[model samples]
Target: MVIPWLSVLWAAPIIGAGVVMLMPRRALAKWVALAVSLLALGVTVVIAAGFDPGGEQYQFVESRRWIPSFGTGYILGVDGIALALIVLTAVLVPLLIVAGWNDADNAAQRRSVHTYLALTLAVEGMVFMSLIALDILLFYVFFEAMLIPMYFLIGGFGADRVASSKAAVKFLLYNLFGGLIMLAAVIGLYVTTAGSDAFGSGTFDFRAIVAAVAAGDFAVNPAVLNLMFAGFMFAFAVKAPLWPLHRWLPDAAVEATPASAVLMMAVMDKVGTFGMLRYCLQLFPDAATLFRPLIITLAVVGIIYGAVVAIGQTDVMRLIAYTSISHFGFIILGIFVMTTQGQSGSTLYMVNHGISTAALFLIAGFLVSRRGSRLIAAYGGVQKVAPVLAGTFLVAGLATLSLPGLAPFISEFLVLIGTFTRYPVLAVLAATALVLSAIYVLWLYQRIMTGPVREGNERLRDLVPRELAVVTPLIVLLLVLGIYPKPALDVIDPAVGHTLTTIDQPDPAPTLADGNAP
Candidate 1:
């Protein structure tokens, strides 16, 4: 019998968490967590090896009824997009454990090491489940379940314990509010499926909803359908933390440790974009069409707004948080533009952004740990004292600005080219934000890493062996993907093609005459 790899992948981390909790040695928990996370990563590698690249259908599926009355079940599967994200999740969690190991050992955090490691493991499991879940109810369950661990990760262990607590509460409240709105939409979908001739009975499976909606079996009122779309979209928007809905992020990133910040910005935020693609566009094509202009306007506004605001920020972590807001704008624009290049670029951006941002946060953490500060202006002449650290920061900063031959540059270029095909004005406006992004990144790097050596910074140490281990993988990945992104694009394109099929949208072809003239 074939192993249920998706189920096993999700369960491995949780089981490891339990093992860590049961161990008598508290100091050993970090090693245990690292071991567990690596094991999960190994499982993901095996799954990827076995994954079918040519098919659009869900692979490695496992389904069993959980709540029959509502047609809810423990259904799990992955298409190429889901598989790519699963690999990303697997890669980051182990690195998180490694990068945060010192923080976990500090006197301020020594007592809670087990809890911190366990929560990290559990969050990995929850994110994996959310990515693979086929049932809407199951997805929601894992979606909300992941937050509890992260809430504690922020409040109980990070810098400024009291402020961190407030940020955690704010984060929780915002997400819960969004989740509740989505919960209502999920129920509405359930009811529609129950009454549909195509279903004849209720179903919470995402596939069933997509099929029934495509066949017009729901016969839903246009107004009601719009409302349902609004519910899911708003929930995802809040998570995407789109402009104006993004107030919680700067606060959370400012107060949390760099390790926690990486998880939040790099891994967690993708859920919002993932939901927008998997549910919003696929399940509600009409609503997506109706709302496309409004969303594109918001995205363009966010790209400019985030970059402009980031220029004025003094806090290093908070500035990075704002940069993500701009990056997410690109991701969202790619999805809503309803073109294959756009969708694939947006999906690929999620993975590339995660790598680049995590490198930034981890390297930032090392510098902050040495200097005991996160203020961009607090130190100067870092390169004179810590050249290795300065160099790593330069690569990460260059990646953030989407410098050519880096991973982000490729993703950003695709998004612009795709968006330009249909929304040229918005694309041009978004392109201008690339300049603003460059300003913030280069300016920040200049203030922190150049000039004559500051008195205190003269003694600053470069990245130690462990710190090098934490960031080197990310830098290597940036170079690898920058030069040749075909492997990832291959996995992503088929899934994107399937998504466009569900929405009944096709890529707009450009005329040869227009191309030549341009």
Candidate 2:
């Protein structure tokens, strides 16, 4: 009998969250949470090991009727695109639990440690469900639901309670507004399908809709389709926090605890870009192609805007938040470019950015915890007192700037190359962020980690064993994926080819001196 791998992968965390909440001791809760996350990771690894890159587009699929009357169902599956993110989510949650081990204990308005850990696992489960849900309605339900736990994680536990609360509200308001629009879009899609003879009673199954669309059976008015597409795209763009819609990210990321912030940015946020790839492009190919130019333009603007803003930030955590905006810009750019390399790089970027940002932000959080400040001028020579911490911080910082031989470097290279092929001028414009990123990262490092040891910084302790355990794996993954990204690329490439094929996009052929396509 075939095992329900997708069900097992998603259910483990949610069940573990319940078990964690029942634990009597804080230490027990922490260990149990870590063990549960590790279990999820193990399950993910087994699934990955069993996954055939060149096999069916979505492997380990499970489907069952949920509401036959409304045409919705319980459906789960994993393509390579989704699988890569599943690995990222699974790997990061365990470390995040480890990193935030004491975050709740020290919060000004303290909550139970079990509550915090349970919420983290809850978020993990919801993210897992969102990534694998093959039914559009199922995906949307969890997509909106994950925000509740995240809202509390931000508002209830942070260094500054008031700021964290405000940030949480802003985060909620922005995403909820986007989700509300997406709800209308979801209904619109269902209504459209219900009317079409192709689907009979209508269905929310993603594969079914894509097949109908591919067969030209999804005969809907262009104007209505564009409107529905806008509804969905608006929500995703807001979630992806692209440019103008990105105002909530910096505030939320800065105010939340480092681990919660990483969960939000590194893992949760990828759902937005992932939706753009799976739903927007496949469900409404014409609409996606129609708005491609506008999306690409916004992406380039975000790349430059985020980097430029980051350079001027006085707070360390806020600076890192802005850098994510810049990095996300690249991911969105790659997705909209409609090239194999671009999409693959975008997919890989989601994972690499998670590792790199987790390392940088968590390390910065540790330093802030030590010094009790997030200011740039708070320290002058951290390396003198805590050489190991300083060294790790430097490596993470370099990775953030996409230094060569680091994980992010290859991802960024492919994005630029992919974009340049289709949109040269915009690619050139986006490349300027490389210099901008270098300035901010190097300058931030120079100010915090180097020079003479500051008066207070001299007493700062290096990373403890727990912190080392958290930081070491992330750093090693950055190095390993950096030096050899082939393993990941192998899984990602075939999925990308499928997406490009579905969208009717082919990689551009190079031309010779005679102007003939090669």
Candidate 3:
């Protein structure tokens, strides 16, 4: 009998959340949540170990009848793209559990530690489900449901109760509005498929739908398809929090605890970009193609806008939040470029960004907790008092700027190369963020971690063992992946190629200087 790996992978954290909610002691709840997340990580490792990069497009797939009347099923699967994200989510949650060990204690709102841990696990499980679900309805259900726990995380526990509460509401409202639009698209998809001879009756199986669309078996009016595509893309872009639609992200990230904020930015937000790659492109290839230039323009604008705004931020955490908006632009740019390198780099960027952002944000949170302020002016000469903490913060900062020998560098490099090949002007515009990123990152570090020992900063403590445990792995990953990204690229490349094939996009052929085809 074969193991139902995908089912187990998503269910473990969710079930653990229930178990944690039942724990009598807050300490036990914390340990149990950590263990559960580690178990999930172990499961992901096993799946990765068994997975063949060159094998079937979707692996460890599981399907069962569910709501037969509506043609939705309990479908689950992972391609290399989803698998990479699964690994990212799994790896981060355990560290977040440790990093947030005391974040809920003495909350102004009287939030319990157990409740916080349980909610974290709940978000993890739901995110896991969203990444693996092969049924569109199934994906949407978890996609929207994850927001509830996240809302509570933002509102129920934080240093500033009022700000946290307000941010939580903003987060919920924006995502809920997006979800409602996607609901219409979901229903519209079913209606279109049910009316077509291709599916005979409506079905939510993603693979089946993609196959039918590829084979031209599910034909609909182009305008109708475009509308449905817009519905899906709107939700994803909001979730991706693409510019103009991204107002909710900074406030939410600033008001929440560092762990919760990292969870939102690093893990949860990837779903938006993931949905764009997985659903928007495959299900509505023509619509994606039609919207490519417009999306690329928006992405380039976001890249420059986010970096410029980040340089002006007074709050350290909010500064990092703006930087993410910029990094996300790179990810979106890679996806819409419709080249294998672009998509693969975008996918890899998702993972690299998650690691780097989590590291920088959490380290900053640690510093903030010590000084009891998030303002950049609150500290100077931190390195004199806490060299270990300062060093880690510097490394994470460098990684954020995509410095050479950091994980983000290779991914960012790939995105630029991919973008330049097809859209040189836009790529050139986006590349300007590299200089802008260095400016913000180095300036932030100089203000907080350098300068003569500031008053009151003299007694600051260095990273304790627990803090070291939380940050070491992330830094190591940045170094290892930066130096040798080929292992990750090997797993990611084939899936990217498959996605390109499904959308009928071939890499542009090389040409001679005279513009002759090579």
Candidate 1 on 348-409: residue-level lDDT in tens? Answer: 89999999999998898889889998888898999999999999999999999999999999
Judged by whole-model lDDT over C-alpha atoms, candidate 3 comes out at: 0.95
Candidate 2 per-residue lDDT, tens place, 272-368, comes to 9999999999999899999999999999999999999999999999999999999999999999999998999999999999999999999999999
Clashes of each: 0, 0, 0
TM-score of model 2 relative to the true fold?
0.99
- Candidate 1 residue pairs in backbone clash: none
* Candidate models: Cα lDDT each: 0.88, 0.95, 0.95
Better of 1 and 2 by TM-score: 2
lDDT against true structure, model 2: 0.95
lDDT rank, highest first?
A: 2, 3, 1
Write out the backbone clash pairs for model 2.
none
RMSD of 3: 0.8
Give the TM-score of each candidate. 0.98, 0.99, 0.99
lDDT of 3 by residue, 1-518 (tens): 99898888889999999999999998899999999999999999999998899999998989899999998999898899999999999999999999999988956756888889999999999999999999999999999999999999999887889999999999999999999999999999999989999986998989999999899888899999999999999999999989889999999999999999999999999999999999999999999999999998999999999999999999999999999999999999999999888899999999999999999999999999898889999899999999999999999999999999999998999999999889999999999999999999999999999999888888889999999999999999999999999988999999999999998989999888998997
Ranking by TM-score: 3, 2, 1
Candidate 1 C-alpha error for residue 356, in Å: 0.4
Model 1 alpha-carbon drift over 4 Å, by segment: 107-111, 512-518
What's the CA error at residue 149 for candidate 3, in Å? 0.3
